[model samples]
Target: MAMKAIDPQYTADTKYALEVRNVDIYYSAFRAVKNCSFGMERNKITALIGPSGCGKSTVLRSLNRMNDLIAGARTEGEVLYRGQNLYDPDIDAVQVRRSIGMVFQKANPFPKSIYDNIAYGPRVNGWKGSKAEMDELVERALRGAVLWDEVKDDLKKSGLAISGGQQQRLCIARALAVEPEVILMDEPCSALDPISTLKIEELMFELRQRYSIVIVTHNMQQAARASDNTVFFLMDKEDRAGQIVEYGPTEQIFQSPKDERTEQYISGRFG
Candidate 1:
């Protein structure tokens, strides 16, 4: 079957890449995230930071309908992309995922060769390119992730044979292979070493020039260091649902939070 195109309302004039409105997410009867509203600017990196189990990841997954994969998981309200609601009935979840790619907390490269790892997404999406074109595409994605130089000499090697950092980069290159407009990362550096984390942070800056990025991170320092904007979430004690405490430019969020809860969280006083 032919894939559905995004609604024609997608004009170049839209200011934000994504506008999340009054979004609430639930797993079965439990509300995980409540009333999230924020605009992710074009070609910028936005960080979602909060303590664990506060629904930061839940909200991140909803942006691309990843939550739908979980049984009994659902989302209410809208996630707008180019003026069209992604949750609309006619919207294609597969296409939504293609347009908005994801990189999880741990690097998970397919057990295939390095070249095949990068080529997999495009191939799955029905790439009709010739062998030479596929090679070029693989090279482009690997270079984009800054992994080309290290792995170029061994494209046939198994992706798992690489170092953990290299495996993460390979996973990133795999995501880049499909040329997504928005990239959602969930604690992408949590398992990496400091050097690997630094490399990923640098890659995020480079990628921000071409793609909109939203990352869910537990590392406050990483959020402050790498993101253009920050959204802080906290669990509502009574309801046990996560709620946004503040959303603003990274500098402002780190230096001077507006909400006392945000201030307390950032200052290490409480979760």
Candidate 2:
């Protein structure tokens, strides 16, 4: 059977595929994310674009609770997944991560074979299936990631054996194997060359057909081209905090943003 996603309608007004409601994140006594609230539509690509250290990646990691690993990193408010509060004490952070996947910049593939990298998730989750089934899942994931043709004959090769671009795609396939509902990517193309960046941008469009993708990127042009919605974050007056400066349909934000900071950032006048 095919993998079915959270319904499109349910992904929309039904609390969004992922909703960050009045979120406040702090590192020890210092606040990072202010009372931020946003809803991500289902199967859509939402780009979180901002300058360096503007908390774009922070928000992305918050979606999957990756920030919790930091000793003093604290989060307040709710990260709702399909209407359920992800921060609820009853929720399993591991389970939350499985359902909502993430890919980081630099294409940090595992030190294992390509096959093992993709199989790792399901295996740890007790897939306990036949070899054929595992093989099928691997191929399906690679194809979904648009990487099968480049890697099919060399599944036994170490993941690090591939080119930088291909390694990123392999990482993407690894995320896909679990069939997660959301894919949180942090500056995914920052480490790639222009050609590789273009390829990843194209991949982002294709991936959105099945998964809700939230990406944090410093490249404004990439955001304009790949995302359905754009969220622009900029540092505050103290330069110690960041907030969402502007957010709306990609067209609006790029064409005529409501804030002066957005225009400055988009036009490359200021950070």
State which candidate has the highest lDDT. Answer: 1
Candidate 2 collision pairs: none
Give the clashing pairs for model 1.
none
Worst 10 residues of 1 by lDDT: 1-10
How well does candidate 1 score on lDDT at residue 100?
Answer: 92
Instruction: Please list the Cα RMSD from the true structure of every candidate, rounded to 1 decimal place.
Output: 1.6, 4.0
Q: List model 2 lDDT by residue over 93-156, tens digit each.
A: 7878888998998899999999999999898877878999999999999999899999999999
lDDT of each: 0.93, 0.88
Name the lDDT of candidate 1.
0.93
Collision count of model 1:
0
Output the number of the TM-score-best candidate. Answer: 1
Model 1 lDDT at residue 123: 98
Candidate 1 lDDT tens digits, 50-123:
98889999999999999989999989999999777899877889989988999999999999999999999999
